[model samples]
Target: MNSSWNPTHGWEDLVSAALVGTDRRPLPSGAATPEAELFDHAALLTVRARAGQTPREGRPLEAAPQERQPEVSRAAGDRLARILGGERPRLLTEWLQAAAARGHRLSPHLLPELLDQAARDRSIRPHLGVLAGARGRWLAGLNPAWGFLLEEVTAPGAAHETWELGTSGDRKAHLGAVRAADPARARHLLEETWEKETPQDRAAFLEILADGLSLDDEPFLENALDDRRREVRHEAADLLTRLPGSRLALRMAERAAACLHTENGELHIAPPLACDAAMERDGVRAKPPRGTGERSWWLQQIVARAPLEIWPRLFGRPPGELVRMKIPDWGREVMAGWVRATVLQGDPEWARVLFAWDPLADLLAVLPRKDREDVAAGFVRRHGLDGQLIMVLGGAAAPWGPDLALAVLEKILQVSGTQPWNLSELSRLAGERIDPALYGMAERLSPEPPIQEVAALLRFRDDMLKELQ
Candidate 1:
């Protein structure tokens, strides 16, 4: 016996004897049976370990502030529970958005689960400010994990004290609120502390300016282009490029004008011979990616950053006519650059023309909601079922109107027999996107497994949304 062995200090010795067996390592005390003695010591150790500690007294918790907004319908809370339980979890955002829109707060029982969900998926956090209400914020203060709830609450015209003393997120939310209300004031406020801010903070604060960008911001953005950090310079140049009249845009337009021109009703090509220092300063990268040629990269950057309006003026044609014109050489490169410009400038005229030339999914963002469906349906008809067709459909606005729903459903049925495998993704998209009102029509589409799955999902969504109301 190791006379020193006791429950308080020799727990490991007791465990070692039990692990090594009675013959190899004797029990702490010679007894009737080694197993019995070992069990007795382990039991005593367990009891001592549990009873030795008392529950430490915790500070009294502050009561959660009362939430004034009415609670959502009992049915809606049950639907949220089902969503949290993994029944169509993607619809959780829709449930939260709808509940908040109707001025309803979540029931107290569901706040923890939802806060945990928002912690995982940031996209839903924006909707939580209203839906989670005052109680959620109070709950967030007690737990570090739910701190996002506190950050999301931007009191209108937040006091200057938040910017001066609050956490990083608090300062950002405060600056964003000010920016939303007055762009110039936000700019001035940021300038006051710009020199003191770290590179990362400078870059993040600069992005908030994007929400309400104007010509008034050009001087500040231009100064930022000279910032020591590469990220700061990159962000500044991007903002300037989006501002059509910025000096950087003008430089890019001039450089592009010298490279491309029209003659004999065909567009000509003249990519830059070299990427100059000025071009680099204005945000053009001199080095190309692994497979891209240097001159081709320069050409793409020049055309992309140049204002889209420049084409109509220099080419003596509207965007539609210019997009249709032949480009004998660098055809792909030129069109690709134009596509970049269309997205950055958000030129619907150019986006419409570019889509007519080539039905790109990226162009859909600039089109109106109705136009998106119309153009996407037209593309599905013209291109038929293929990878590109699926890519185009992905960009179209959801709760897809009848035209696109019918067009896609027809396409799915038309090709179901020949291409059952391809129909799965298309069918899933249809089920998820097509308006719930059209559930009956979708159910009648076909008896094929993919179509049947689509019908089932549509019906589920229909019921899901009804519960929210």
Candidate 2:
């Protein structure tokens, strides 16, 4: 036998013998290794080894440095809690903006939740950086989930290096930061890597340009119209259309002018015979949907892309006056295309006038919130409680002003029994959008199924809004 012994090997042998049983495999030969003595010896050895064990030491944790900025007041902290708890979450943006404006730092305990919120709602990331301050950035560095906050907090001067060296997401965020500070620099940065970027990346980066978009970007955007990717070309065209004076818009205006002309007091339209290369290069798709004819599709694109001002210029009248005029056969098509263009360009005057004529949901959503509610109220008085009007009203801001809420209430009470199907969705909308102060009026309605349901929803929303306060 070897004189030097290994404790591990000895333990292994003892364990193997114990597992096989001393009855089947006899114990090792010796007075000290007797079957009855074997267990006692093993137990002694195990106790000695265990007692001798010592844990390895690790580095000590450092205390977090104190923040120099003052913490938000308890009232403000409670408000943030309500906002993050899903009570009127849309107000979170407003709250953060206000807090940032005041230079108020969040309570350190709230940093994790705010960082988590920033991760989920990327739209709030920029605002979060200011509120979260230095400590929040430190915490973000320790966790991958909160890593996105880093880019939003990075200084503009350091952004260039990060843009060149970071991952795709980092580069995009850096681009947005640079864009806000300097639009021209943002465009140049994108141009530097334009040829190297993938088609998908190029398309995504082009969309960020819309934030600070101006006439200065028209040349680069106009050149992007010939990109190999259809999405890239479409994005470029869309941005160019927002600039009414761009050459692309001029091209579209010229095409539309040719297709539509005023003869006598009426409008005459001859849709295009073919989608020529020049038209396609200007972002008109040659292929139409399966059910639509090429000519109608071409006409819609031309009208939609051309500047809304082009119409008044061509017809020598304001949009409202021209829209009131009768076209022989294509009035609906022409008006619909113009509505789409008005929405795309976000022309509030055109949207306001068009809403008077059509009261469409898309058009209503584009108007300023107060204007939207006011317009809906006018429409409710004019048209009464119809399904279409209710749908349009749903697009306005919530907790609607007294005039609009009262109009909606009156309409609901009038049409309660007649249209149960429409009432279901309208009841839900009422609950979400009606002013909480009107809950008493809503509650007084008879406990009929639809009325009761609407009342319950309204009361619930009222309570929810109250909690936020």
Candidate 3:
């Protein structure tokens, strides 16, 4: 009898009744969705309701159905070696076609081999439009690894294409990797397509290519500052601004130095100043500084152009003493920009001094290190006991480089008082710049609860040491 009727009993009651009847045949759960499968089992009914007709004895078996998409198996990728086994042209062309047909998201597991092998084949390469031209650039557009092929398939294929292809693959990865692996070679690759790409693409490509953005990349980036595209100009400007060590920064530093000076025991600068013809010749320009808030404009251009090194000397006689000096209302903001420049240059000593001036000074220190020691000490001194850093450094972590910074730190946190500010502010000052010495002093003077908890962490020394007795 075909039944098509609603029952007064709920699914659980029906299952219990069926269980009592001894109808033990298992339901066809493999074809059902998980929710439907749950309704078919008497065992679940017993477990959920805490009542069973017979005593519950065994754990229920998990029943997750296998997902099926037969055509796009991993083997579909591995079979490329044999599917067009003998046809060279067919082998090459078909591979590209297959990938194009697969839409943009290549099966994640097979993508590496697919990209390496497909890019090497010259004939398959010429037809690569199957992604850009045929697949309609949509697939490649979404995937940075493939989107890079835009210039490659259009240009000639050479072994050097590996560098071009490999580096361009940076779209998938971040600039940090490309910058780490040979900054010069990557910069040159961008230069080749500098004029050809759309202004939008050009700006973006340069932004990624901006890895290891050193003093050398300055001239070219400066040239971009004048590009017709505002975005291109802004990106170039943004990078130069970030580079506190650049020649542009040096020039701005000199200009800003001229403005700070003597007045009745006060540092003095009126509301505004123009980037005279000389400043403009040197790439510091202010257009009609009258109405556009000239003081801010002059300050922005100068701070952006100035090298961080000028701050201490420009504002006062001694660099160390400047730590105590304060510029009235606007001077601190103006000086803060100078500090950011110092941090961008990745100079520890300068960052240390600015760091001394204000605890919040740490934000400006977004630096990189050629040798880990530079940043490592700062990290340990600041965040040595921080849970995240401890996890990142691993178990055998011993301090390396500038161990003295920790001593400096121990003295600082030792200062008495309940964290003169906010808890969020404490998290910010952690990492390399944290001082183990200050941590020690803080512990010694007034033990914080978290500090005690951190001290209580389980440690493992060789049990063999105990066995020696």
Best by TM-score: 1
lDDT of all the models against the reference?
0.82, 0.76, 0.47
lDDT of 1 at 218: 96
* Candidate 1, superposed: residue stretches over 4 Å from native: 1-60, 100-104, 117-120, 128-149, 153-213, 263-266, 273-277, 324-329, 440-456
Poorest 10 consecutive residues by lDDT, candidate 1: 47-56
Please give, for residues 113-181, the per-residue lDDT of candidate 3 as tens digits: 444444565455434432333232333443454554554332122234344343332231323344567
TM-score of each: 0.75, 0.62, 0.43
The local lDDT score (0 to 100) that residue 12 gets in candidate 1 is 80
Error of 3 at 205 (Å): 3.7
Model 2 per-residue lDDT tens digits across residues 127-196: 6765776677677666677877666543222346777776565577788889999999999999999999
Q: Please report the TM-score between candidate 2 and the true structure.
A: 0.62
Off by over 4 Å in 3: 1-183, 207-216, 238-247, 263-265, 274-294, 311-316, 361-364, 367-469
**Which candidate comes out best when scored by lDDT?**
1
Residue pairs clashing, model 2: none
- CA shift at 303, candidate 1, in angstroms? 1.1
